[model samples]
Target: MDFPETVRWTFAGLACLTLAALVREIRRLRRAEPGGRARVRWDAADQGAGLVLTVGGALGSLHLFGAGLVLTGVVLGGKAVRAVRARRRTTVGRPST
Candidate 1:
């Protein structure tokens, strides 16, 4: 494979691995706390995965796969933003230790 194709596959593979890890974490949390209060906080890895997926999708040129990847990326990115906002909100009123 050429450079661009190789890069694309690499990104895609990384994104998939990130996604798999996220799913595993979620499942573990669910099992540990069946009440559903265990939330998955989106971190840097999630953000990076979303970004890679988004760019890869845009450059992929395959309609269906591209659309799916783009949509997943958007959702992941949005969730990460929301998680950050929520975290900030929780700490806003607390005095610095």
Candidate 2:
């Protein structure tokens, strides 16, 4: 089945957004003052705005652009959640004395 160009381009843009999100979150994750463990939060408004702008620029207002932006947002959001989960998992169930 052939996927719409909107969907395909959107998916690609979304992947790129996730990558950018990782870069941004990685910096924050490394810099965060750990109360217990470090968790990356990529849902920052700034990032969202950036996604909108990035996707918008990548795929103008051809309707597909909006879809691309939404996909990008989702990818970024998923990455954020996964990062936190990974941090939690790593910190949990350690061999205690």
Candidate 3:
């Protein structure tokens, strides 16, 4: 199916933003640790989210808009799962037992 010029430009803008966000997140993940340590560990979940966003952006750029939407769903689902887990953890710590 053919898309209009506006739709194409919109997808291109979204792709650019996604790529920028991915880069920012990766840099954040790679930040150094304290105590003169030149490195730090990273969370696999966060890394995976970054990867998903990157793939989504690439798909959008390549005109695979549907696939991009699917990947964006994946990224959102991951965030929701993480948020639920974090809430559960915090609530569990404050148990009335």
Candidate 4:
């Protein structure tokens, strides 16, 4: 497949991930039971990861359109690292029970 197809699939996948994560987070927050700091931390981590995915997808798509090719691997590699960092932050912060 060409850059266009690759970019399209990447964008679609990012959208799906965002949609699913958002739905899950909303459901978690909507529950009557109070959520502890850990839950909140994980939620925030998820949001941060979503941000990276969104930005990476947008940039990759733009480059693919304007430049006729995208460094999708590098762009997404950085984004994956960012997502890992966010998860680390969520886990590192100690939460009271």
Listed in order, each prediction's TM-score against the native is: 0.40, 0.37, 0.58, 0.40
Higher-TM-score candidate of 1 and 3: 3
**lDDT tens digits by residue: candidate 2, 10-97:** 7568748756885776677667777522234444444554555555555544454465557667767777787788888997888757
User: What is the lDDT of every predicted structure here?
Assistant: 0.59, 0.61, 0.54, 0.58
- Candidate 2 global lDDT: 0.61
Backbone clash total, candidate 1: 0
Clashing pairs in 2: none
TM-score, cand. 2 = 0.37
Error of 2 at 77 (Å): 13
Worst ten-residue run, lDDT, model 2?
36-45
When sorted by lDDT, best at the front, the candidate numbers are: 2, 1, 4, 3
> Higher lDDT: candidate 2 or 4?
2
lDDT of 2 at 86: 83
lDDT of 1 by residue, 1-97 (tens): 1237776777667667767676776566556644444244343335444555544543564554455566667667677777798899999999999
- With a 3 Å backbone cut-off (N, CA, C), the pairs that clash in candidate 1 are none
Question: 2, model 4: CA deviation in Å?
Answer: 12
* Ten-residue stretch with the least lDDT total in model 3: 36-45
| lDDT for 12 (candidate 4) | 64
Residue runs of model 4 more than 4 Å from their true location after superposition: 1-4, 35-38, 55-97
Error of 1 at 34 (Å): 5.1
lDDT of 4 by residue, 1-97 (tens): 2346577667768767776776767666666366354455456455545645554565554433333223334445656776798789998888857
Better of 3 and 4 by lDDT: 4
